[model samples]
Target: MSESLLAALLALLVVPALLAIHAGDLLLATLTLGGYGFAMALTWAALGAVDVAFTEAVVGAGATTVLMLAALLRTTRRRSPLPGRLRWAALLVVGTVGLALGAVTAALPPWGDPDTPAAVHVSPRYLTSAVAETATPNVVTAVLADYRSYDTLIETVVIVTAGLGCWLLLGPRSR
Candidate 1:
């Protein structure tokens, strides 16, 4: 993707994020956040991470939005306002974290650079020997299911736990 297109996508991502943050209505915030997720998916796609983009679109923009809207159905539309001091404190913390992250990002190699540590260290082994090592034809599948089995299992467990928690919290309550 061209630099201008990527920059535009990044800019688009920020608008919905800011809108979601500043939105008083929970519904509006939820919708804005969905837009932010979609924009994030587009950004990921532009960066040549199509799998990540699909996951973001499905889980971030789709499932998350549906879940939030369902939760909203059981709650008030408007959120309780935060006190001035607390809001400022939250903003300060967010700004500090954002700046720190920006600094770290600026220090990193360019996206998809072939000489990055990850690409140089482990990726070549995975790309060349994944099929023989794991008996999986697809490198991504082999990596996720075989090489990174524990990580993938933990991520699955976390997702399942989150789903259960959401269900228990949002499901019909008995008297």
Candidate 2:
């Protein structure tokens, strides 16, 4: 992708995130978060991680937005105002964390740099040995199901647990 298009997608992510943060109405904030998630999905797609992009679109934009809307339907639309001091303190903490994360990103290797540790060490082994070792034709399948099975299983469990929690909280009362 062209630099301009990628920059625009990244900028799109920031705008909705800021809007969601400042939105007074809970519904508006939820919708804005969905927009942010969609922008994130697009950014991931542009970065050539289609699997991650699709997952983000479905879970982040689709399921999360729907769940928030359902929860809002069960209760209120307007957000309770935070005290001024509390708001300022929260902003300060968030800003500090954001700056720290940005600094960490700056210290990382460049995107897709071939000399990075993963590219230099791990990826070649996976590409060469995955099928033979795991008996899975697709390298990605072998990695996810065989090499990183526990991680994948835990991620699935987390998603399922979150869904179950939402359903228990938002489902109809057992009258």
Task: Choose the strongest candidate by TM-score.
Answer: 1
The local distance difference test score of model 2 is: 0.88
lDDT for each candidate structure: 0.89, 0.88
lDDT at 118, model 1: 82
Instruction: Compose the digit string of candidate 1's lDDT tens values, residues 1-175.
Output: 7999988888778789999988999999999999999989989999888878999999889999998898799877788887899989988999999999999999899976989998899789999999788988878788888999999989989989987887786568622
- TM-score of every model versus the real structure: 0.81, 0.80
Residue 61 alpha-carbon offset, candidate 2, angstroms: 0.9
Show how many residue pairs clash in every candidate, following the order shown.
0, 0
Instruction: List, residue by residue over 1-175, the lDDT tens digit for candidate 2.
Output: 8878988888778899999988999999999999999989999999888878998999889998998898899889987887899989998999999999999999899876889987887689999998779888778778888899999999999989987886786568622
Q: For candidate 2, give the lDDT of residue 96.
A: 100
In model 1, the runs with Cα more than 4 Å from the true position are 134-137, 163-175
**Which 10 successive residues of model 2 have the least lDDT summed?**
166-175
